[model samples]
Target: MEATLPAVAEELLREIKKAFQETSHVPDELLLALKFIFGSSAVAALDLVDQHSVSRVVSPSGRAVYQVLGSSGKVYTCYAACHFCTCPAFAFSVLRKNDSLLCKHLLAVYLSQAAGVCQELSVSDQHLASILLEEEEG
Candidate 1:
């Protein structure tokens, strides 16, 4: 009855979310834990969060998506539900070779969510659909 790695990670994220709710910042120990768990992705993800580059876009019907603006100014779409990111790093590292758990963009989304720092935007369902289609086509 041992908890799996993913379960442990999810629990840790929940704890981080609670800390964010209480203090508006992750504690140093939790930050270290993230770094240990995620390696370089943790550092880049924190930088993205500090830069205010992660966003949560939602529609009236409750559909939502995550977006992260990379250092190169390209926006990457991320789906939290599937742990999927539309970024070259995600494709080459996370999916293709399986060398990483997530791309920096996906990690950024997770960190921003846990820290409650993502820019939240509400859009019409049609607009959200348009955004999804545009990302897919591009």
Candidate 2:
């Protein structure tokens, strides 16, 4: 069986998207321009990332693996330890580039995990096993 994300996860993604769309992802140069105008400290691009877009799901027994849906509406299975995502962005940017960089899905997962916004769910052992197998086979 497939592991499922909660309704809260989708809602949170929407909220994160909305919040992120406004005054977000401004590069440091833009921040520098703003700072010059306002005489304030410059903000970095990383500061604008919305960590709340991702929602993590765990089994009640803490043994299931869950997939995350991205802002593009695609499901990406992520392996935390490897800093990997099944998304094309990871394959092209991180894996192909031979670096530890992350795609948006992986970044969201990491950020959400850090912010404690990942949602945990109850799933069967098979669900977790299937996810792991898919990762391996993929």
What TM-score does candidate 2 get on C-alpha atoms? 0.54
- State the weakest 10-residue window (summed lDDT) of model 1: 1-10
For 1-138, candidate 2 gives per-residue lDDT tens digits of 433333543444344444445644434554344344323111211232242445455655675343667656666787665556787867886678753344656545644543445676666667667767777887
Local error of candidate 1 at residue 12 (angstroms): 2.3
Model 1 per-residue lDDT tens digits across residues 37-130: 7788889988999999999999999999998999889999899888888999889988899878878898888888888779998999999999
Q: Whole-model lDDT, candidate 2?
A: 0.52
Q: Model 1 compared with the native: what TM-score?
A: 0.88
Worst 10 residues of 2 by lDDT: 40-49
Tell me which residue pairs clash in candidate 1.
none
TM-score of each predicted structure versus truth: 0.88, 0.54
- Model 1: residues with Cα > 4 Å off, grouped in runs: 1-5
